[model samples]
Target: MEQTIQKRLPVGGDSWVTVDVYGEPDTPGLVVVPGVMSDAHTWRHVAGSVDAWPSVVVVNRRGRAPSGALTNSYSLRTEIEDLGVVLDEFDSARTLFGWSYGGLITLLAANERPIPQVIAYEPVMRPFGRHALPDLKVAEGTADWDRCVEIVNRQISGFSAAHVDGLRADPHSWATLRRLSGPLYAELSALNAEPPPDLMAQQAEQADLIIGQRNRGTAPYGTSFDHVRQHVVHAEVHELPGQGHLAHIQAPAELGHLLNNLAAI
Candidate 1:
C-alpha cells in the first residue's frame, strides 16, 4: 500500500472539503465520488488495481470526519457544487466515476456542464425515488446509527441479514458504518423531494454505466437502471456477473480492472 495524500480544498461556499489521493501526483487520473455511507478509502483498492490510474482522488463528501457537516440546508445540489470544485482541481483527469448516490451526483453534475467522460455504477435514480423510510428516521432521531445502517443496507441496498451481522462484528468497519450512516438518512430524505432523473440526458458525453448482474431486479438499483437508460440516452450499460450492489467491496480488483479498461476505451 502507498501513502495517501490529504488535500483540503474550499468548496460549497464557506466550507472546506477533504479528499484522499492515491497513486503518484503527476499521474492524476479520475475523480471518484463514493456512494451513501462511504468515504474515500472505500474505493482505494479499486484505485490501486488500475494500471494506468496513477492518481485517484476520492472526495470524503460531506458529513464525514475531517469534512464539513451536512448543513441544515443540505441536498443533492450541495453535493453537485462540491463535486464541481473537486473536478476543477483535476481537469487533466477528465474522467469521473461515481457509485450509487455519488453516481447520481456525477450524472447530475455532467448535465449541468460538459464532461468528456462520465461513468456511474448503479446510480440511484429510481423513478419516484421519493419513497419514505420512516423506520430509518426513527433510528436516526434516537442516534441509533448501527440500526440506521442496518435499515439502509437491508432495505435500500438489499443486503441480507447475515451480511449486515458480519459488518457489525467488525469494530473498525462497524464504526465507520455508524459514522457514515448519519448522512445517508438526510440524503435519502432530500432525494425524496427532488425530481426524478427523467431528463438527465442533457450531458454525460461518453456515459458508461455499469451494474452488477445480481442487482438486475433489485429495488432502487433495478428501477435506477431504467431511469438512467431512459434519460441518459448515450449511456452504455454493462453488467458485472455474479455480483450485486456491493461489487466494489466484494470484488474490487475485478470491478477496478473493468473500470480501468473502460477508461481507455
Candidate 2:
C-alpha cells in the first residue's frame, strides 16, 4: 500500500504541518482532522481504505506530534486558525471530517468558510453540556510534564480494559491514544480554566451535525448536541448501536461506507 506524504508549510509559521495525501491529487478532496494531541498518522488506516475519494488530506494539528511547539495555552480560536491556514493552501473543494476535539475545530472552521459538507464522529461539545467529566481531574499549579502524563495515564487506565483493548487493536486509533495521552490532559486543564461557551454556540451554528447514538463519551453524555440540533438547519443525526466514542475505529468499514455515500451526495 503506497501513500504520498508531504510536509506542507502552511503560511503564518515556520512549523511545517505534516500532511498525508491518499489517492489521486485531482480527485474530490476530504480533509481528516485528528483529535487533541494527535498527528496526521491517526488517519492512516482509514485513508488507505478510502481509495475511492480523489484526495484525502490528514492533518497533524499544531502542537501535536510530527508538528512543532507544544504551547501551554490551547485556545479554540488559535486551533481554528491553524486549520484555516491549511485550508488556504488547498485548491480543491473539500469535505471536513473531525473526531472528538478535531470535530470542535472542524465546526469552527466551517463557520469561517463555505464548507459544502461536514462529517463529525462524535465531536466533544462538552462546554455546551453534551459531555460530562465527573472524574476528570484538572492538573494545575504545576508545569511538570511527568505529572501531566501520570494524571492522564491514571484516567485512561480507569476506563474499561476491554474498551482499551478494542482501541489498541486498531493501529490508527491506538497510535493517537498513545501520543495524545499526556497532552490531552494538559489541554483539558487549560480548557477548564476558561470554558468556551460562546465558541461552542458558534460552532454548533456552523456545522452540519452528525451524532453517533452510542457515542456516550462526548455527544451522548451532554446537552451540547441538543442545542446544536436545534440551531443547525442542515443538521442530520445517525445512530450507530453497539459503538462508542471511537466509532471510526470500531466500525471503520461502516463509517467508510457512510462517508462514501456522503461524498456521492
Candidate 3:
C-alpha cells in the first residue's frame, strides 16, 4: 500500500482544510471529492487502487473533518470557492472525480472555473425534480437529525431497511452519518431554494457521467440521468454493473479501475 500524506491549506479566516495525497508526485493529479457527510478518508481504498498510482488528492470538505471546527455556513457558491482553493493548493494538471453531492459541486464549479475533465458519479442534481427536502426544523430551531439522516438513506439514496439497521449497528458508521446531518441539512436547503444549474452551460470539454446499473431503477436517479443524457454536452455515460449509489464504498477497486482508464485517455 502507498503511504498517504496529509496537508492543511488555509481557506481564509482561522479555518483550514485538509487534503490527503497518495501516489507519486509529478503525475497527472486526480482530485477525489466525496458526497455530503463524507471526508477524504472515504476515498482511501479507491485512491490506492488506481493503476500506476498516479497522484491522487482526496479532500476533507468543511464539516466532515475528523478534527477541527466546521464553517458556520454552507452554500453552493461557498463550496465552489473552497474547491477553488483546493485546486490552487494542489496545483497540478488534474481531473475532478466527484461523487453524489460532490459531483453536483463539480458541475457548478466547472461552470465557474474550467477543469481538465470531470467524472461525476450520480451527481445529486435535481434536473428532473426536487428532492424531498423535508422540514425537520422545530420552532425553537432544532431538528430531528437522526430522522433526517434516515430519510436521506431510505428515501433519497434508496438504502433498504436491513441496510439502515446494519449501519445503525456499526458505531463508527452511525456516528459519521450523525455528524454529517447538519451540513447535509444546510446543503439541502440551499439546493431546494435555488434553481438547479443548466447542464448544457457546463464549461468542461469532457464529462464522464457514471451511474450504477442498480441506481437506474431508483427514484430521482433514473430521471436525473435521463435529463443528463438529453442535455449535457461532451458527456459519456458509464454504468457500474450491479452497483448502486454507494459504488465507491462498495466497489472501490472497480471505481479505481474506471478512473485509471479515464486518466489514461
CA-only RMSD, every prediction: 2.1, 4.8, 2.7
Worst 10 residues of 1 by lDDT: 124-133
Q: Go through the candidates in order and give each one's C-alpha lDDT.
A: 0.79, 0.59, 0.72
Quote each prediction's TM-score. 0.91, 0.74, 0.87
Q: Per-residue lDDT tens digits of candidate 3, residues 155-251?
A: 6667789988998999888987777776666666655656665554277768888899987846667666666555567788888888877777899
Model 1 misplacement above 4 A: 1-4, 26-28, 126-132
Runs off by more than 4 Å, candidate 2? 11-14, 128-158, 161-178, 189-207, 216-224
For TM-score, the strongest prediction is 1
Task: Measure candidate 2: CA RMSD.
Answer: 4.8
lDDT of 2 by residue, 31-146 (tens): 88887545676567767666546788888776665666545444666677777877776657368888767876787677667776777766655453212223333332344443
| Number of the top lDDT candidate | 1
Could you give candidate 1's per-residue lDDT for residues 77-113 as a string of tens digits? 8899999888787666667899988888888888887
Pairs that collide in candidate 1 are none
